[model samples]
Target: MTADRSVLPRQCRGQAGMPHEAPHTAPPCCAGPDRENHSGKDSTGSDAGSDAEGQRNQAVFTPDGLTARAMGISCAAACNPACSDPELRRLLTASGISAWQTDRLREVLALAAEASPYYRQALQGVDPASISARGGLHRLPLLHADVLRRAPLSLLCTSQDDVARVVTLDTSGTSGRPKRLFFSEEDLNATVEFFSWGMLSVGHPGDTVLAVLPGERPASVGRLLGTALENAGMRSVAGNMGQGAPALARLAHTEKAAVIVGSASHVRHLALAWQQAGYDPGSIHTVLLCWDSVPPAVAGLIRRIFGCRVLVHWGMTETGLGGALGCGHQGLHLREADLLAEVIDPVTGTPLPDGQEGELVITTLRRRTMPLIRYRTGDLARLLAGACPCGSPLRRISPGRGRTGEGITLPDGGSLYPADLDNILLPLAGLHDFEACWQPWAGTPLQITLYPAPAAGTDRTLRQQAEKALADSPLPAALTRHGGTMFHVARTAPQAGFGKRRIRVIPQGTPPLNSGESYHEQLP
Candidate 1:
């Protein structure tokens, strides 16, 4: 049966006058298409209105639409202080454009040109006036991880006095060095607003949310998400998944949270623990999976265990929380107001047409502290042309294939990625935990360490499952079995510092690769 769209529980309404509170159930002040007011037109040609009453009513009355409406109001209230003016929403709705984009781009460019030595040197001979007009990111040089680590953090352009917070992001620990990013007061506020709005697309206001991300101190994403939830009248609790699943289960039960957000691996760990304790997370309304890809099999298992909707998202540390998120239609909708995303040929760096697969590149339009222009993400994906059915004007990126910078080069000229190996092994039933390591000889050899499911009760059964998974692959035949685990060696392994584990593809006689080396040195 279709859920009713007009009924609202009293608790969901929250305190009056709060922007994050659910819209009042009262009738809308203006009458127009879809019972919404026509104050102006949005970029997609949708009508905007001064009907605060109408928006409030829609937030509580429509089950499917309420969450999204509440989220929008919350974001509008938070970001309006820094990135947008109070009239910004009305202007966007009426004019069909976000004024923040124009204003932010101007501010960021001015900041970069004035304060950033790196940008000043890189942009030499390039006219500032014509920079915006130039299309395609390949025109700009790629910002490698090493450059970011060695450069002064102040090169990000924001004044140290205006900076409100600092966040250090470690990319899988494979880099061995983490990069620290600075956030301005405006940047933090804008991020909170964006996340508040995005969360509403899938969840209702005042719904409790549980977070299971890394770090004792909240990550940048976590802090903004928590603020957004509070602004929307929702209570949130940050749980440490590293402390193990039992701890997370206790928090979820105590908090009675409606949604859980974290990596799929972390969530799966908690789910297995909950199952062991004979507790089912049926009370959860949704699960927002981030960081890593969620396999189809795992998605089903999570849904079955939690009895909640599962949503996946994609983004990077440099972009704040502004990234693409999947809607009910299973299509990823990019936040076009904040970023311009593109896919290009990995080898030639030429832009690829829509629907063609290539490396993903991103340019931040809203970021003021660090405006990443044509940053090569090293992720493989394709851009989808045309509008989404959800009525958003944002761009979309198809599901990515493998890690951009790290992959094993096979003898036959084929490539293998840790992501590819994860996809292949994660779905198998008897598998518990596994790590892939690459050792190089004449060619790279892949060594996989398998952790069998405890329920299997026998090492022999686990070994069979492991061998079956590697049988058809181009791995060597001498698969070794140790305890309950099995190791399979392949002809090509990942490069040093690429895999999450200590997997080295450097030839036997070659020296170990260091973090100080550039991408060119490794590739050549």
Candidate 2:
């Protein structure tokens, strides 16, 4: 049965002052014979600016057409800023082109098979023309991360000279080889275009944005984001989190930044520091959390401390830094024109119904340099059951997301995840960071070390508060009642790095050590 979207509950709406104008859309990168490109680059040499940018802006919205910006949609309403324009309903639903007729998909597949060594071998006997008739992207074999680790160069569909940048990431285990991803100029430009469109949700022209992410490298996320914001007619300052929270707060105050973007942990730390120093929260309008699973406690604390709208972004380097962007409501809106997404059973590799939890898989529709086909993301999430309250035609991904292989078995036959502790501990006042160790054979099965914020220092009362918070949670409370737990307050400053947190599980037979000895285990 078709659900009634107009009457759907307004979940996270009510934020005022959000603009209703459509963002700039890039010139058609996937233009076909049927779809002609009429929009010329703006004075900034990027996407055609918003409608208010004057007469030279030629990009027009056609329900049947798609562009690199996914044809930016403007949701017109004061209460629900996340909804797309009612016109998008036709573009994404009934009037959209079929998979067989999409020129972008055909172009990507042809390029991969023709120039990429890996795709040439992997797609043997698999005709691109038969894809639509056989089944859509689901019929293709799943691409595992191991393939990238084993042979990254073979996946390139462009000339070596055309490669603009290569990002290398170390694998989890010690002996594993690092995975490398290459991007060409056009590929990177597409990412910038998407970023420009996504940033419009939080910022406006002439607004200053502070990006608290790594910007030292030329191809770093911060640099690309800065370029995107500038092209969108905003002032952007890309700063590093390693400069510490206090320093960033000072910069934000000096610049009067309207928006701040960083990972959940880093932004949480900054918010705590900003509050401790008595900084006025009115200067900042929004905080964008990305790069990892967002904890509810952390998000709540940030919202309370900053008194600003908090939005979560779910994407990875493999996704070209732009996958699903938060709709400022309940879920994330997929970049439908640039990528194809699927949720499949993790155990059986079968496609799952909407609202069912499964692994996320992506197929790049416009990427030309290194096109990833049906790639497994190892993230456990689900497509939202019904249409969004905002009436957007784009598919939505539920906010509850976690890494698939991150669960650790407990003594009571239950399982614990990093999110379990993050939900309980991260919001505690005066707390900055923490590390958990699980030693099942010892008297204290769960050990935690707390790092206080610089302003708070290492106080004994903070330890008590941490214990009480954990004691209130069901799983940790049960474990403490039966197996006992340990809490230690560290005097050293908290690590400023924004990597994901995990609990270290010690082997059963290992000898118990004194709590005084440092028990910091390296995280993967």
Candidate 3:
């Protein structure tokens, strides 16, 4: 039986039935993507001239108890000679990226030394206090993934009673043993606050948001997203993607959803499903995407098909929840207040300058349950050179290339990224989405499969064109030699699990590949 849905409801209004372009009164209280910036210093926020500089620095949004600037965490004008301006120093020391994190980093190091056996042994002879300032994080050794897997419980700083959630991270064929992370109530609350800020970017009070991620499970992304929406005066519904698209459309129509959030491809799946079910995509004003890198073509197709704006969000289960979200101005804006970010040479682990592509490493500013110090995120990205157009002094980062572990490593040790494949395939006519896997073993050759977009037709000619194009590329030519190093490439309809987040690379048929297969090379 075919399902029918109506996009039109009695009210097509914005949140709480307020006018879409309505303005909030001056004196903004929170840091959200959607809120207007009125620093009250001058027309130009950051570029304000001399006399207004101090007053302009006070333009930072103070969300009640979250910022030290709000509470007046003080330091003498001469305490640190780095900055000539007192307000600038206060901003950096209080609410800026280095602000709270400088102090929090010290606390975590002390906690790791006191409680976690893994970090204690890892930090053997080092003094936690000496390495607690800005740039002090790099002095510490990298906490390898193996240590987290082998000594999982040894990473916990809090007792079981204080731990509210324990999430096992999927190595996704990158690591031998998966990492299990524990979080306290306060840690979870931090995620909720982050989400509140992210939601504020696209939504408003009393608007309904339909999420396709996990909703029913406790501490799940969807559930926490719902809680965050509630905190910001919005309603949330988790469609779960389990009951199929028609059911999801029904829920959205019933709730009058103004926004939809989902994993990378799942947003496309839901939007397309709603379209096919005869609902107007215009019913939803914005789309929020996370969990993977989106090709430029996919983003365009989604925008055209859905008649809406697309927001890219970056985060990990390890960082608690979302740490950064795109403000649609330039790159993704980092949550400098809660987390400090660094880009480092993947192989050498030395820090990279802004605008230089490298591996992203993070240090949680205020987490207590399981504090990760200078934890390697394995994602390849570069820091944006300047402030976001949205005018928040918080730093922004490039939407990353795929994970270092997700790259396809050849026998000779050169690598190809899934994003490289997306770049080649997404532009082709009749192409949808594709997944490539290599089963390199003693007898078997590497195997790759390309899936056509839904309703993109199963004609072999279109498939052959894609294959030939890929074969002509440098990546395939290197691997598809006549004798020693051999590989296989084929095309098929979308695989078994077509909708949700798809693993770009799989190894040995079952379990994910070990860390050796992952590549962290920076692209030009």
Best by lDDT: 2
Q: Residues 1-524, candidate 3, lDDT per residue (tens digit)?
A: 11111111112112112233254432222223232221121111122123333333332221211333322444321121111233433344323445456666777788887888788887777776676445566778876666667777887787878888778775544547778888887777767766754575566666788887865568888778877776555778877655655577778877889888876466665666576667776777677777667766556555666666677788887788777776554577676656778888988999889999889988776777778777888888888775443445567778565776667666777776766666566555455445555545524244334445445555465567776766766666666652222222234333323132323433344543232222111100
Whole-model Cα lDDT per candidate? 0.55, 0.66, 0.59
lDDT computed for candidate 3: 0.59
lDDT of 1 by residue, 1-524 (tens): 11121122233323211244445442232111122121222211222334434433322211112222322434322221112223323422312323334344455656676778787777565544444412423455665556656764745776577666676656663555677767676666666655655665445555788877543444356666776666555677887755656678877877888788887666776666566667656677677777666555565566668766666777766677657776533346666666667788888888888889898887677666767766677778787777544443345677565556677665556666665565556555555556654554523245455565445445556556666766654443322211111253222222212113223354466543332221223432
- The parts of candidate 3 lying over 4 Å away from their true place are 1-96, 174-176, 246-254, 410-414, 423-433, 439-448, 452-454, 461-524
Q: Give the clashing pairs for model 3.
A: 34-201, 173-512, 173-513, 432-453
Candidates 1 and 3 compared: the better one by TM-score is 3
Off by more than 4 A, model 2: 1-103, 132-136, 172-174, 399-401, 411-413, 477-484, 508-517, 521-524
- What TM-score should be assigned to candidate 2? 0.80
Candidate 2 lDDT, tens digit per residue, 14-87?
A: 12111233442322331111111212221111222233222112211211122312434333321122233343
How do all models score by TM-score?
0.72, 0.80, 0.73
TM-score: the better of candidates 1 and 2: 2
